[model samples]
Target: MTAIPVSAITIVGLGPGSMDDLTLEARRVLAQAAHDKQTVYFRTIIHPTVEPLKQDLPELRIESFDRLYDESDDWSSLYQQIATEVCDLALQHPIVYVVPGHPLVGETSVQLVLEQARKRGITTRIVSGLSFIEPVCNLLALDPFEVGAQIIDATNLAISHIDEVAGKIIPTIPLMIVQVYNRRLASEVKLALGECYPDEWPVKLVRAAGVGEEEAVLEMPLYELDRNNFANHLSTLYVPPVPELSALRLPETLRYITMRLRREPDGCPWDRQQTHDSLKRYVIEETYEVVEALEENDMDKLAEELGDLLLQVYLHSEVARQADEFTLGDVYEHVNAKLIRRHPHVFGTVEVDNSSQVVQNWEAIKKQERASAGVDVHNESVLDRVPQATPALMVAQEYQKRVIKTGFEFTSLQDVYAKLEEELEEIKQAASPEEQLEEIGDLLFMVAKLAGFLKVDAEEALRLANRKFRRRFQTMESLAREEERPLTSYSRPEWEKLWARAKEAIASN
Candidate 1:
């Protein structure tokens, strides 16, 4: 037994609601405080240990923050209130702040008190006791370390986004969610876990652990978790691993699978042989497939194509990992940082009147970033940022788009139209095939610039026109087939009639 300094705030745990589990040191500390007529404060007097402790030590001056719970609807605010009051009392006199379970296990009030007290130059000591984890693990007949169990706060998991939860949860391991407290929270937890876990996944509810006859363990499907009012303050839900379903449910599982596929002699030969340079084509292909799915307005195809695109990213990341260049984490970090850094109007204190202003701000931030990174900003042209491998039409449009940011644009649509006409006339006046090619290129460039002046995407406009032509031509071919005549044998008038019929059919549709 060691002496707890009378000048400091000594925090004690009353164990997991069982008097037999309470530490001798905790008992001695309370006795010592009782003898000194010092008040012992409990975070709540509702714990089973509280009434028993009072009966065991009649002279113990016990007080509690149970009234704070009744007064405040928000648990966060209630914990803060208790912490502030406890720290305030510690300033006037030595305080003994007792809570259920180990002070550090899941005691928010104890954590707050410790932080606030220390910041105010007050000393605090933690008297350890058996936490709920030990008894819960014993009841479940599993070792937490062996199962690699994740202990999550039910309140936190209940309120978090599915994506944020996905990043934390791994379905191929044991999960222990603590502080279920009530059915309402259990429902929220059920819905949250359902996002990644099957609704019918088996789970265990262990309540009042280590508290003798009051302790109960119930097994049920995850979907039925909140169907009854069995959940209480001492409840903990244990989720066992579902390895077969993990790949389909968990985001981390995909990362692990990608890594495993690249592992050694037993791994996939094709995946093992891939390099970043070789996988570049797959990235471009998957990207266009995603765009095609979007253009077709197919949600299911979009989701599937997006997964394919994501796989390419994972493949490239794995290759980089093998070469000791970078990892997937670095990719996410760089892009996330860039997004937050460039979006001042959304992330920072900056405000914008319109999207045009947002674009200007983005460009300005990019320039600042390049200059700060010691790039030769003076020698770099804005057009150099456009990827050379983009489609020809897209590349042409991007060139005009970037140059226009420097205020090199036609002030009026009439000027744009005049430039287009001038280029067309030059194309007609060309005397050689080489000059004709050059004039045609100039004409196309002028058309791209005209598209920008009209606030239209030249590439998208061309794609739409191409799709229309394909549809009309397919209709004309069907008409020719129905007439039992070959398209090659059709004369000019016949072709014109076929085209008119196809156009009329398309407009009717």
Candidate 2:
């Protein structure tokens, strides 16, 4: 209902060093703003150009928030406070906001101010000047594109930014980490980068870059970053990419694939139609294939199959997103938190002796997690987690392990054998088909228990057995064809002989 203040906001950069690097357009605007009765705001007056400009324009009422920097550890909150203050002042009078670099480059306050001003229908204009990068290139005699150099802001990093954006450091290119104003900020940058770049990798610390001949470029290992005598507002850490490594993180790529497959109007028909329920079978199938690859010691196939399995994770997360249930980040966070919580030996102060002890600790942590979530673990059955949807053999094996953990297991392997024999005899003496079925079931479950006691994965062992049987039966059939004897014409004795021959052939092969 009121007039929009679009013409009231002006953002100007003070250039890299001082007035010498300031743009002509920026200079002109500052001169006009000096006597216009407008509120002048400097992001900080620490830069050499600030006092010089104030001296040139004595009529300008200059304000600075250097106190906020001294008082707050949170840069984001500090920037928010500055933005609010600027907006409040702009509401009363026009604002000529000045920052050290280009308004959009590593200028959080500038962005926040622009956002607030836009919400009030204010028109904002950016008067460009030389950013640090310009002087840096000249000072170092380096071409940014040739080196694939990228810039990162030290103040904006968080766990949420790890792989979603520029935080995913690809070591194939050189990185220009800016705004490392102190040892603390430098340490944060070093840790965030340490995820991809090796600890001993060499990185450069360029102080007062582009300011003049006084600029210094210090080279040292990444671990020794921020250890220099001179590191302040003018400091920047340069991380040269590792030559052999190309990419660092996979989330961005996985997110891109998921987005493309689910994009509106033009996406894969099969992918678009798939839901979590529809993709469950593929997840199970891909898992088995991965197991097969691992068992066969096929590294190439294993890598490919693992990618297929990870794709299923992305697909499920995408489905969750569409349903407003969760996002990929939630999936990552859940697993990451669980890992850190359960592995107190790694992330916390708890200690362990062996992997067996680690497993015990993991199970205890799981119980605590369940109880925290209001689950009645004490009242829950031992078989509560032996999922019925899993393969019968695995379910039996899981049940056995659970019961054994609860001290309800067979006394010895001999007891297990005795139970197996009793079940077999019951199968032989079954009074009805239903009774025979029960006995057969008991026999298979006993075998599974034996497998568990022997530390074998019953499901995988059964699958291998099935594969071996199929191969031997196929060989027997092939031999029958070679003899030109139809199965209808072969006697039971002839079939037995052929089976023996097949076994012999396999052993010879």
**How well is each residue in 397-507 modelled by candidate 1, as lDDT tens digits?**
888878877988788999989999999999999999999999999998888888878888988888889889999999999999999999999999999999999999999
**lDDT computed for candidate 2:** 0.80
Q: Point to the candidate with the largest TM-score.
A: 1
What lDDT does each candidate get? Answer: 0.87, 0.80
lDDT of model 1, residue 313: 84
Q: Flag regions of model 1 displaced more than 4 Å.
A: 1-10, 28-41, 58-96, 113-125, 340-361, 372-374, 405-407, 431-433, 474-509
Clashes of each: 0, 2
TM-score of each: 0.84, 0.56
Residue 47 of candidate 2: its Cα lDDT? Answer: 78
**Candidate 1 local lDDT, residue 474:** 100
* Tens digits of lDDT, candidate 2, 97-188: 88887888777788889888888776678888788887776766779888878777767652224554444565667788777777876776
